[model samples]
Target: MLRMLFHPKSLKFLACIALAALTFSSSCKTVESSSGSLSEKSRTKTDVFFAEMYKKYNPYPIQDDPETPDDCQSLFKEADPSVPYKGVVVYFHGFTACPQQFYEFAQIMAKKGYSALAVLMPGQGRFPAPFNNDGKKTINGRKYKDYYSEYLPVKKGDDWKRYLNFVSDVNTFAATLPGEKLVTGLSVGGQLAAYAYVERPGLYKRALLISSYLGMPGSYSGRNSTTSGGMLNSLRRLSGDTIYHITKAVSQQGSNLDIIADREVSWGDKCYQQTRGFNGNPGRRGICDFHVENIAAINSLGEYILGQIKASPALTQIPQIQYVGPEWDTGGDTLLVRKAIGYQKARFGDDKVNACFFPNVVPHSMFARKDIAVLPETPWINSFMLETTKFLETGATYKVSQEPSEETQWDGASDQDSGVFQNRCDVYAVDYSKVSP
Candidate 1:
């Protein structure tokens, strides 16, 4: 029995366990040392201000992880700490993405005299300890984990509150800084920024929403594209208690163990990249995989905000929002964002909402370095940033494109009657009444 217990296979298993233990121990010590040095080297006013919020929100004790580099973590750029800050621009990144998405814009804003902050949302970044059944799950007697990335801690039930609370915390942090507080975001982050502006009337000085996820795409849902609120309307009417209980129970799960097993059946394939990496954002640092249930939770938050907007009697504050995106987002985001903008316009007047949808050249989330690669025909990215920076500073209206060439000869053509790169590269004059529900 003793010889059998110490068989070759058993010894090999023990050896593997020993090696893993040693590696984990070394990793811990390295993390501790690196964290100490980082704190001493670059602790700033922004870091000091957000320390409390980090403690309050982040599940893991440490901020940086081996998987998540310092550049991709919560970022703040204040060009001159000694000099007074003119204003602050708060950035919220898209779902499954980190603060790095807005790093370039934040740095630009900082150099332009306004301080900028890109927040790291909760359940993002790598956790210190192993989680989600240690990234393995058993399905039909077989076990597997996502090959591309590890399982993130974002859950289906409480993520709604977590996301909202993150917004609230960021707002509170921004309130402490000097000058005007401007908000901007991309995708789901865009929705959060809009929610913040709507919920806290007169709080933000201006807002920019890029490729905002206002509704589910037909390709993903296997149904017609519908606004988040509309989707909730159907789920509330049809799913009733069953859906509610399932979501609630899933939320209560301590780990993503069950979600891992259900991935193939419910969530479908995990998207590794949004664009084909040729002319669009060539790379991303955020999680490539997500649970569909968590997406539902995000949509619910959007739905709640839409309900609030529709029910409000009147809009307050200055007309200071710019919506920018690609011309024809097949995911149906553009149309729904247009509709949301329409609703706000009907309620708040035309001057409150502004938009610019680039023609065929650009793609979704068109901000990364590679996405904006300086090609002969695509010098518009730099122009877009310059104009955006100008708008943030002076509240002047701006477009994503430069003046159309004589060859294009297009001037404010309708979406239908437009050629490639000529689809209203100017102020979007959307008729609020015609924008369907």
Candidate 2:
């Protein structure tokens, strides 16, 4: 028996157990309290949460990769501590996107005497190489080459817990800030923002959701090909460590890196060509990566929000809300926006809800700097900033104008007539119950 126990296979098994123990021990350090201001306490909690999360999922220290940009890092823009400013705006960026998505908006807020902190979502704002461990050696094997770069290595249930913890900590910090508290988010961030609002009604004075992803559009769901693949991947990850590693290695061996890179570049170019006001530079566009597990996590959150709205038809203390939707958004159904507005109004009176739809302009990333409307005739960015300031200051709502068509020439436009731009804005009136799933 002793001789059998000393076999090479047994030794390898022992080593794996030892490794797992070490990983767990290192990742589960006690969070220490630090001496600082009240705001610093909130920051400390956030830092500690991420530290444990990174240790568990990404055991290796992050290497200094030249490919990563500074803007891709998380940001906390503090207002003048001396002056009593209006308050803080806690901004959350979309899925796979970095804090840079809201960095400009934060700056605009800062300039207007309001502090802004753009919280980086868990598993975001990192170099893409860390997540390329799917064991693909070629582009053909990787169906999502163009959009798979810099994605988070999310392992189902654990990832969602980490994300919720992040949201909680950030909101706690927002409470410490002076003046009024405002929360804003885009895409998945929007979903999280809605969760934050619903979870802590009185916490935020106002909330703005841009292209909130309540549900997948019918067209998008029909076109999706990775549902089965994602299910299989989730199963593999849930399997024991030995089996998971073996399966991952087998999958990675067949991929071609050069082909993957070429495809990524080609896709990026196409996106630039199609998008108006898009900076020609590569990688400047917000993350195009998609992870099925992440999508499922966001969807779960959305479902929870809907359920909560249904359970308590009237919320105790709902904040003033602005629901901004894009007519051309492909990620989420426009009808869901209508549904959300309807639910909010039903729960918290019609006067509490406001809705705006930008027609013939912008995608799901409506509030992102890259997607901000910048037609030559319309300084949409400035107007949006002013409107945001007004909303935050007095809870005032602006109706989307139905202006006549103007012949505006966009970048790379042909002589063909580009139709007029229409703005659809209204108070919540639709009966959400009547809408189909």
Candidate 3:
């Protein structure tokens, strides 16, 4: 495996993963190859993005057990500061996610003429864990207690500290640079951006949150409320005596051993609602389902976090939010985002809260619904780049209501279970001059 991808060879590295199962989506779609080899690109040849070089930082040896670093700073492991940005981008990853996964998003921002900095939050990287398949027989599978990267559910109130430091660190890093500094986050990263926007206002000029939620109250489901005792994992190789940290590992079991409430409404339900499986796994369907919390937790977390953000003291309390997504996302996250719109220090929707609802299918979700006008499928991986860079420059307005156009199947409505949706919304224009001058 090391021979396969020790260095960043975009083309050949993809081929190597193809030989192995590069687990992705249920849709079996082909991700476009990144145009060039980053190997030739001038990165400081740093092995791991962050948290490596354990020996240099700590005087005493560190143990993986309930791992805690004494000197862990309030900031992130930054890239070379000498690398300037015409525009600054501070990025965050999602649940059970790795900073490496946002390569597509980062590349997109870079291509859009921005200096992109992505952060890997604590409890989200390579933490050693044992596989949970205590099976009957070991068919050449020597039954040894082995370790793998799995989702170590964040203990209650723990994620906030990590995110707070991450946001502050990103802000400090971006402040020293020049150009339009924008904060963008995917999945949970979006949440971080919102928090940072509120807490450390004016630090980021704009926020691009993809597949994230805004403030809302939660609907609880009866379930375990325990501090999940597992390790956050990364997808690295298990070398002879030590486990190598490659990509981050996600959990198969933990406090989230089962699906969220409701068999139909939740994103997890929608993921499994599909007839086809993704990346060969039937369960890993839609965006919401993949390692998501219950709706209540989602709402509570959003409210708790974004509320703190909204209440925070920023230079211009309200940083404009450009909400973008397909119908499914529009109805799901936008509803909560609308609530968040009002909480911003700036007046809500005074061109400060922009929305764009795509009348297309979001690629990261289950494909079980009608996607007659699904946007070009190829742009899945690269959409973040385009969307983020484009939005910061334009800051245009968009809103798509669920109301069907004249071309509706039955007076612009379907009898089948279409789930919740939005129509009659608009797409943000590609170009907008001075923002709220």
Candidate 4:
């Protein structure tokens, strides 16, 4: 049958050829389903996006040396039984970021009563095989020249699928940890965390998304609208066939789950002040600094996370929600998670589903005050780990989410984007005393 060669390992082009042959042999099949909510829509978008991406972007195996350092299992902490240990803190590295990048946070969480797990994803941990070229640095076996562009491998719509599979994988790993686990993603990992919250809710107690783009869903631009229209038409024309192929692929782990960067990014600030350059303001931070900022990403991440909590399957309201970023005490990441926990307690108290947003926190410091680039640190990170540990142990609650009109978000030195920041809420915390019945 023409469908014979159509498999994941079926190297894209060959599948096209196989589909071509099948055209002569059988009738077409199409897929159908019901959906609503951000998660479902995001998944739908991701699937369509990846399918299109695979057609354009080829996934070649890259070279990676799978080395497990002795420091792998170094992070661990005792879960407080007084309160349920929702989950451990698992750190995922960004592109080319090895376990080293997260050592500070990971070790701190472990000491703070969390069983921390830090692993690499894709080009992160180990290079994919297909070796050649003296083993220096290469992707798909070429000397690593244009890494961010070529190897990073992202497409416009893959956000959802990438998130879904990633959470599934993280959960599988969490199951093996000392206790339940929460996710703390950085940069690209943070983006994955946002999508994962939508794709897989309740998998973690709460998530900390740092320096990520948790933008809005749905296509708005004329180009995306038009492309989406064509896709709909194509799906209609080859409904039967498309269904068969997609269903089969989805059955096999959503093979089309690759994320590609949007040539023209749509939602979120195209570029923040820091993202552009240092500009010379005390409040003004840069992309490199924010990448290490927890709160900035959290505010954006919180918007989407609130969606995840609202859309939760079990509707298990968490005791707390936290996002730590810069613009806090001394421009450090003093935007504690405790505040968000308090907020969740106030609004949807006792449901246990808590979500909070902290601002960007600068870790120690890297360069001169102006040119200084921020990264995560261990000593300062210990606080978050301790708070999380305490939350798990004491089941403490907090209140942070106050009425938006009541608070002035841009009052101080904020580099907030319009509609995104300007209008914000007065702060409150969660009430830990109330737990779900």
TM-score of 3: 0.51
How many angstroms is residue 38 displaced in model 1 relative to the true structure, after the best TM-score fit? 16
**Candidate 4 regions with alpha-carbon error over 4 angstroms:** 1-87, 125-151, 156-160, 176-178, 194-201, 210-212, 216-319, 327-407, 411-437
Question: Best by TM-score, which number?
Answer: 1
Candidate scoring better on lDDT of 2 and 4: 2
In candidate 2, what are the lDDT values of residues 274-362, reduced to their tens digit?
22123422233234444344444555566566676556544577788887765535556444555667666776787788766655344
lDDT-superior candidate, 2 or 3: 2
Off by over 4 Å in 2: 1-70, 81-83, 128-162, 219-286, 312-315, 371-379, 402-437
Q: Which stretches of candidate 1 lie over 4 Å from their true place?
A: 1-45, 61-70, 81-84, 127-159, 219-283, 313-315, 330-332, 370-379, 400-423, 426-437
Q: Candidate 1: what lDDT? A: 0.53
Task: Estimate every model's Cα lDDT from 0 to 1.
Answer: 0.53, 0.51, 0.38, 0.34
Span of 10 residues, lowest total lDDT, candidate 2: 25-34
lDDT by residue (166-221, candidate 1, tens digit) is 78778877787678889888878888888777667777888988777765432121
Query: How far is 46's C-alpha from truth in model 2 (Å)?
Result: 7.4
lDDT for model 4, please: 0.34
TM-score on alpha carbons, each prediction: 0.62, 0.61, 0.51, 0.41
lDDT of 3: 0.38
| Candidate 3 residue runs with Cα over 4 Å from true position | 1-85, 127-160, 214-300, 309-316, 330-334, 345-349, 363-387, 394-437
Worst 10 residues of 4 by lDDT: 25-34
lDDT string for model 4 (8-50, tens) is 3335435433443543110011111111222455344334432
